[model samples]
Target: MSKIRVAVFGCGAIAQRRHIPEYASNPNVELVAFADPNKQRAEEVAAEYGGKAYENYEDILKNEKLDAVSVCTPNYLHAPMTIAAANAGLHVLVEKPMAVTAEEGEQMIEAAAKNNVYLMVGHNQRLMPPHVKAKEILESGRLGRVLTFRTSFGHPGPEGWSLDGRDSWFFRKDEALMGAMGDLGVHKSDFIRYLLNDEVVEVAGFIGTIHKEDTDVDDNATCIVRMKSGAIGTLMASWTHYKGGDNGTVLWCENGVVKIGTGQGDEVIVELTNGTVETYKVGAMATNEKQVPSGVIDDFVQSIITKTPPTISGEEGLRSLKVILGAFESQDTGSIVKL
Candidate 1:
């Protein structure tokens, strides 16, 4: 079988540092080309990976015999790029949060379905070993019924992480669509949904730009959710959690509770009503062991070969986006928004 040809549509830090290396080393994939609006950055990444560089992403879509493309562009570009790739008959692996809005995410899903191509979202947290174990544990029914939960993802604002520091789209409402909620809250929202196997039906939230200056979006946000299953949750997502403590998921259930974090390799720690604390560890993809990001990329490639839907499909991505948007709506109205 011919290795699946892959092209990355952004030479930003994420593409160059993670996606390119993962694709270049995957046995079943060939790193074929790259595209970026910035010519020099695109050329640099392309040269580093032994691939061709195109200033315009359309160039790669029009010419390469690519089986898939990783839409590694910024938050706003995610929808357009994924839709284009799908319409061109290429499987799309979009970076997290799906897109800025549920409507946009729906369009991406529609395009993929219309063209008969796969559309997967890169919610890499779902691919992490610890998170994997947590999901399995919850599914095993050992925790009984979940009553409430809390999850978070944060880092000192994306100053160094983004292409431009404070001036980046991350701080701009027009480009990012939402602040911390879209950036990190959605990951937790997805994790919670996956863990509980429920759709969030209502939300009450507080969204604000508490820390950053001259930013149009929130730097800090908090939300309380009511799931369809009647379980409730409190979530905090911010770019200001630079103090860094136990930053992961915690579920409170009728039987006991489950705590997930990086301290135990992101393992799931379960405490039962019987006063027993058990830990379960989820293993990583061997070739990319010790590296969590590769698991997502590897799965994306495997989905293309197996003609399977990725664990985080485009529809699932939209569900996650809906949660985030609900939080925003809740914030705007200062009332519980029902899904």
Candidate 2:
């Protein structure tokens, strides 16, 4: 089998940390091209990873013969890049918060379907080891039904992580669309939905730029969500956790509770009504401070090889994105918005 030729559309923090490295590590993939507005960044990535660097992504799409492309650009560019890639007959693996709006997400999906190519979204939280184990436990019916839960993803902003530091496009509303919610909240929303095997039906939340200075986008967001299965929970995202980061989730179930990404040593801790306690050292989660193999790149490659839809397909991405959009609408109207 020929190696899947791949291009990365952004050479920023995410591309350098996750997409580029993962794609390079995949034996079945070839790093063929890189595109970024920063010519130096793109050239550096290309020099290190073996690819042609392009100042414009359109050049790569029009000129490169590639099997797939990773759309690791800003939130605003996800839709356009994916659409163009799909139209070019290349499979797309797009980063999270799939697009700025539901309509854009739908268009991306349509383009992929029309072109008969895979469209995968980078909702990698579901693939986290602890979260995977938690889902297994929930599916085993050991925790009965999840009644309510709380999940959060927070850190001391993206300044330290982004390549551009504090001035990164993440802080700009025009580029990021929604700040903390788009960056972190969407991950939690998709995660909870995946864990419960349910969909968010309604959402109400408070989102604002609480601490970050001179940023129009929200630095923090807290939402109450009602799932279609009648499960209710709070979803929180913040870029103002000065001390450290939190990617913890606690589920209150009918029979007991499942705690994930909380314990110091154990990645998952379960306490049952029958007094049975189980602790799992599944693995460490990928954080802004620590980089881990997300399993997303491998999955994307395998899906193309096997000619199957990605686990996190475009439709699934759209579903998860709608939850974030609903929260934003909720914030705007000060009322519960239905998904």
Candidate 3:
């Protein structure tokens, strides 16, 4: 079997810690090139993966031989990079918050379609075993039509991951857009939507900067969602939580509740209507290490090979982005916004 030739833009933490490592270990992919504005960073990461470095992403796109490219840039760069890669006839696995705005996301979707290329969003939560199990149980009606859902995803500030620390592009309105909602809110919105198989029809929400002093963007946000299925839900995302509990999602259905964490070695807990509760530890359930996988990239590779829709396609990313954007609109106008 021939390996898929791939290039990666943005040699940042997510790319270093997850993307590169995952692709490095996958025999089906050939890591061909790396691109980042910072030459040294790109060179270091590329050296580890046995790839060449390009100071400009265009250099990689100019290569006619690559089959796919991973867009791992900041939130703002997602759309333009993905569209460019697609136009270059390369499949794209873009990082989450597909774009800062829904319009941009649509452009990405259109570009992928026009180019006849695969476009997948890197929402790795969908690949977690507990989350996978939750999707299965929820779909099987063991949860009995998710009536209400409340989920939150938060962490300490992006000091470790973001390049600029507290003054990172993440805190800049022009580069990061709406802060907490875009960074964490959208992820939860997407995860819940995938697990419950429902769309948010309306949202009444608020965004604020409860912490992270001197920053213009919101560090905390909460929103109430009206799902298309007539179910109600609430979501919170923040960087203000001092202790940093990490990401967590909870679904309340007619029968019971299910909860999962965003960290490694975590388990999924279930509570049934009869008051019988069970906690299915991920490692115990899967007979493998309980950690996030580069399954998103693996799935993207398969989608490109088989001409199939990725589990988290660009269109799916747009829908999830809509909820978060709607939340911002709701907060600004003090009114419920329809999807």
Candidate 4:
């Protein structure tokens, strides 16, 4: 394919902020179509990006001659849309929390494999500059094995970012599945796994809707995760951080402590046990106020063009989702859930 013809399945906040713009900017991608339930939103995106507007996503899958699609729809729609696109012989780059249930994630993966297409999940935390640097440091064996860690991703809420404002589907249980945990927790879970190169084997947490009104889903969650290597850490997600956002991770290792995304300008800070301090000035983390290229779109497009599996594959997404699900089970049962 000369230029991978791409269509966006949702014209909402994530599509506008990340997917469409990145695809348009990518020299290897030709963004060809946009689909959304809201016709006007789709039309506006198409007008800006030079594509056809589609009100129904099925129409795009049926009519468009596309090589790939970014499934940027709500959480509930991710599995079905990706399965459909894969069945149509198109590669899929789906948003985080790949599906509502593990079964759905498995089905999406099966569809992609059966159709012989790439299925990438948008777990963009691993693409952040600070996170990339931190991973490198850990791999060097300088940190000597992480003992304990804490990673958090929080903001005021999706209301400030979602196109639907306070009434966004992010707060709906049916559409979003889980609120703060699904939106923010999964990112941290995936990040922790990437940083440690280990799976989260056990999860115990307290997840609830503490502050948000008129929402059945949780507004805050605090999970204690134990990795396969016996490293324990805390993973927190909050939509009620009214003051400001915190996307920071701190890993206390045998040799030193590595801090990521905690500094104002410096993105990574390392404090050694032998009284040495090192800092890195990687770029800022993407936030609602300031959007940056997440690198997910480029990775997905390149994987399709090169006929290779994406960095964040469907199985990786499913693993991250399983962590969040285990946390939910722990919350419900008041006992540690084993993954």
lDDT of 1 by residue, 133-221 (tens): 88788889988889988887777777767766776777777777778788788888887888778999998889899988888788888
Cα lDDT listed for each candidate? 0.82, 0.93, 0.82, 0.93
Which stretches in model 4 have alpha-carbon errors above 4 Å?
none
Report residue 130 deviation for candidate 3 (angstroms). Answer: 0.9
Where does candidate 1 clash, by residue pair? none
Overall local distance difference test of candidate 4 = 0.93
Model 4 residue 83 distance off true place after TM-score fit, in angstroms: 0.4
How far out, in Å, is residue 208 in model 1?
0.8
Query: Model 2: per-residue lDDT, tens digit, 1-339?
Result: 899999999899999999999999999999999999999999999999898999999999888999999999899999999999999999999999999999999999999999999999999998988999999999999789899999999999899999999999999889998999999999999999899999999999899998889989999999999999999999999999988579999999999988998877238999999999999998888888788899999999999999989989999989988999999898899899988
lDDT, residue 244, candidate 1 = 64
**Candidate 3, which segments miss by more than 4 Å at Cα?**
262-265, 284-291
In model 1, the number of clashes is: 0
User: Which 10 consecutive residues of model 2 have the lowest summed lDDT?
Assistant: 258-267
Against the true structure, what is each candidate's TM-score? 0.94, 0.99, 0.93, 0.99
Tens-digit per-residue lDDT, 170-268, candidate 4: 988899989999999999999999889999999998999998999899999999999999999999999999886899999999999999988773379
Clashing pairs in 3: none
